[model samples]
Target chain A: MYSNKYVTIYTLVMTVIVSVLLALLFSGLKPIHDANEAVFKKRDILKAIEEYLPKPLDEMSDEEVLAMFEEQIEQQVLDAEGNVIEGIKADEIDLAKEEKKPVDERKYPVFIYNSDKGKLYLVAVRGNGLWDKIWGTIAFEEDFNTIAGVSFGHVGETPGLGAEITDNPAFPAQFKGKKIFEGDKYVSVSVVKGGVKDPEHQVDAITGATITSNGVTDMLKEGLEIYLPYFESQKKS
Target chain B: MSEVATKKEGLFGKKERKMLIDPLNDNNPITVQVLGICSALAVTTLVSKALVMTIAVIFVLAFANLIVSLLRKGIPKQIRMIVQLVVIATLVTVVELTLKAVDYPIWKELSVYIGLIITNCIVMGRLEAFAMANKPWQSFLDGVGNGLGYGIILILVATAREIFGKGSFMGFQIIGPSADYLIDTTTNPWFSWYMPNNVMVLPAAALFVIGIIIWIQRSRNPKLIDIS
Candidate 1:
């Protein structure tokens, strides 16, 4: 039988102790956690150009991924007007937070991978999926119209259906060699169900995941259009 | 409660052993008592996800039990539940932080479920039913037993779902189309005709697997059958 005074004291002490312990653990582990996240982002970015890497992304260690990102990838941050924004690392820009901003005010991060053949530009995109947010890094050939490769990520989507966009290699593989421009018109690749009539710009969607497939379609159209100006400016130069 | 002159039951006596072993079968947290079913259905889609959930639950449950049992005598009856929750929440946070630091990808996948562990009834249930009334060591054993009980069922359902649903185990393709499977359905004589059942991949399918488990368990152990 605890008195009111004792109960109050007990609760206070427990709360204080727990809070202190949690705060300590959180602060202590923050650096390592941040590093892990950075490595994860770098790894995903590199996955867009995985074929060009000397070793498979899976085989590469975290250090190697970071080193490869540093050595091979050039970071660029672009405004809606396609002007390069200086003084910020591309990976440091949080796309989710940027998504919350107004369209013209948001900044986009681009990762340029220097390969033996040419420079493959990787741009990050985020949009809504059936259940939650889905994002991807798209790699484009120097011409900025032909897709070199792609790697997708999702917060929450039905596994084996919508999640196949990331889980199944075949899904992302379809983007390879796909053209995003049709004679100077910026027409981002579309995820088509039933059939793909345009072999160069349309790919088959995951079966039974029509909403998520459509989400990808809409995401690519809007996400890629934002970079049309940047691509155009780079093409002229 | 007096300390009477009696035979000292060493560290792990028969009673303690029961506390550790009973939950694995007769007193299973998932199949028998039907506690923590929400997570059982959600995380069992993948063996890997279920395994991570199991480990996280075990860590939280065992530590929560130990801490609650240790403080049982000092805890006020009026605020015991809140105290228990704080303990569980702290441990769950620890699991989340550690998982993020150690494996970001798995952390990303299991993020929501890991946070939900704070609300997992089994953790609170054991604290209320067993830990508050038991010795620290015995309570710890009860926690582990229940955790393992929940884990056994979780892994079983995940294995059934993943194998039948996706033709894979722990993300390794075992049986499916001939392209990349370890056991190529096109070439493997045994599974040549076997096609993955799409129904098993759905979250609703976990309920069926759990229902079958409960049915078989009750049938085999007549004591578990409801007579009322």
Candidate 2:
């Protein structure tokens, strides 16, 4: 049994040594960690144009994917008023942080992927899910109204039900060719209940997942509205 | 095991090897002692998930054991528990950061559970029971054995659950799609060939599987049975 004086000294020395060791370990690992994060984000963004990639997404190595991103993708960080902010990389924008800022002050990143067929503009969106935050990248065709593809991800949702939005491909596939604007009125898109009778503006809601469905609906309406100014400017030009 | 003399066991001596092998069967951390069951149930839904969980547990348990064994002599009697906790917590954080930076998706799926590794009784149990008394190398082997012991069971249960529940093994579709077996009206679909057992996906299924394993283990090894 250690004496009280010995115990106190031992504790202090152990704590100091452990703390310093951890600090050094963390600092050394930070760059590789950050690089992994960047690659992950890039992969998610690239996933939006998965169908258009030269080879299957699964077959492509990290270097290949990064090369594709550099060669075929154009990055832009946009202000709320549709101005292109220079000097800031699109990948550096953290939507979670931007979500906390005032609407006008928030920055949005757009990834334009050039495929052999045409150009695809991918926009990032984030919102609350049933349990936590859900985010996605929705890619638009040149017309800016027709959805080319979409990729949704979530923090936590009911694994069997609400999670179908991400886990089930049919849910996202239903968005293809679904128009975002009905003759400039900006109807966005709806996650409809019962059935999606109006094919152009709605997709079938996840059964028994009303809250998550509503969350997606709200996410799309608000998330798409943020990029309207930039769309309008592009249309004018 | 107690009859073995207290002579210093060589690095891979018979006694030291028993420390590693015993936990796999007769002294399993999960089945025999019934420790760390919560994580066994939660993460074993898929073989892939269970595999990742296993690797993470192995890393944390081995390192935590080593650190505790090294500090065993100097640690105060009054603050021993706290010291073990601090060591375990530090190791868990390191595992978490490495997972986050290296494999973000699995880390995301195994999220919260990694933090809960600090609470895993197996890690703390080894620190107090074995590491505190044994040499550093022996303690390390014990940790690995227990971690692997826990992992093997987890993988078996997860494989069964995923196959029965999802009709997939590690995300690959082994069974044909449900749409092919639709035999009912548009509103309510019934399967003609086979339907995935929805119950298997729930956490409760792991309990039954674990129970069956214990039954088999005890039946084969009669010495494990206890009767009053």
Candidate 3:
């Protein structure tokens, strides 16, 4: 058993060979892994439009999803001033990287889309929820103050509560067409409990999901707050 | 007693029942043994996704076992685990790719969960404990059975959760007014057969359902109970 000079040589050789094999295997699969990730992200974006997707997601063709998104959406990158921030694609902007720089240097990416009603604005937001990181693309109406639509996804959170803020439809849709500003006031739409009685500036918090509703409420206040200055500057112009 | 014993590779013979049924009841990896289930908790809310995950795990386990068995002799004792990981990772990659090309949408839903299968203790558990010392065929069957056992629980939990908790099966309104409600405004007004309980949709529900499954499975078959 103590043949250090004998069997040990075989162990070393085997280790090297196995390590090489692993490298080769990972290299081959890396492309597929990358492709899968890309597709998954694209699919998440498409999920925002599932109601209007015109087919069951599983049965819906990829070409159909792509065609619908392309026909409906146009991408734009804006600065904190609401002026067009050229020379950068929306997806390429890493706010975490930009956060270290001056706010003026940061480019805020926005997505513009159209339905039969009119135009919609999507602002990409990344912030802290309760447990882990939370991210979403919130759409605003042509008026620049009313919310058109919103979608959220998170790394980890209490299920049925914080997580439902992402998975539950009734929760996200509540923000639809809700005014972020109350007529010459930037009070912003609040996530009110029981029900959002104010038809103009409030969305009802999710029933049975309070902490998550609070997460959504706080995240909205904080996330949307970043764009308030830009929107205000645009209105004055 | 025999010289062939020194040369013997497969410590256990490869039989269909041993590989399949062992993990299910006699050697249940989850209930009695209690292993590998981070994903099981979340996906069990819907039968379709849970079923897909089950099949995917089965594919990974069987193939990982077979490969591990084939290479058990060649693997260096020091780096054997790393090799097993490589094989397992490769198999996971293949499964993930196949899912994307064929069923992109469900593949999307399953998302990163597919790659996480590589970390499933059940696959590694069977490969290390039985398959590594067994014949290829035997190891393959064992993987298949264990995967089935896991799937059985997932499907049961998902079916129960989706039908009762949400009132719909596979995201469709199955038990709407057309079925039994049938135009009763006051008595059967807006009856949501499936409210999609925030808890049930979450993975913790899987643990509760699995607990019930073990309780029932053991009560019916006392021998299946793990006293220890």
Best by lDDT: 1
lDDT of 3 by residue, B159-215 (tens): 877765655677665543234323322345565443335566666777888889888
Residue A217 in model 2: lDDT: 88
**lDDT of the candidates, in the order given:** 0.91, 0.85, 0.70
Give the winner by DockQ: 1 or 3.
1
lDDT of 1 by residue, A18-119 (tens): 999999999999999999888988888888889998989999999999888788889999987878999998988899999889988999998998999899
Q: Which residue ranges in model 3 land beyond 4 Å of their true spot?
A: A1-60, A64-72, A94-102, A229-237, B1-14, B37-39, B76-86, B93-119, B174-198, B202-204, B226-228
Q: Indicate whether candidate 1 or candidate 3 has the larger lDDT.
A: 1
TM-score of each: 0.96, 0.90, 0.79
* Candidate 2 Cα outliers beyond 4 Å, as residue runs: B1-14, B176-191, B215-228
Using alpha carbons, what is the TM-score of model 1? 0.96
Candidate 3 TM-score, C-alpha based? 0.79
lDDT of 2 by residue, B122-220 (tens): 999988888898778878888999999999899999999888876778887665353422232223434345666767877899999999999999999
- A1-237, model 3: which lDDT tens digit per residue? 325554466556655765676577667766766655555655666555555445656675556655655676776677766677667666566555766788777777766667666766677776676677777777776678877677788777665566767756777777777787776766666677886678777788766656656666677776777787666665577
Highest DockQ among the candidates is held by which one? 1
- Interface RMSD of every candidate? 1.0, 1.8, 5.0
> Considering DockQ, which of the candidate structures 2 and 3 is the better prediction for this target?
2
lDDT at B58, model 3: 92
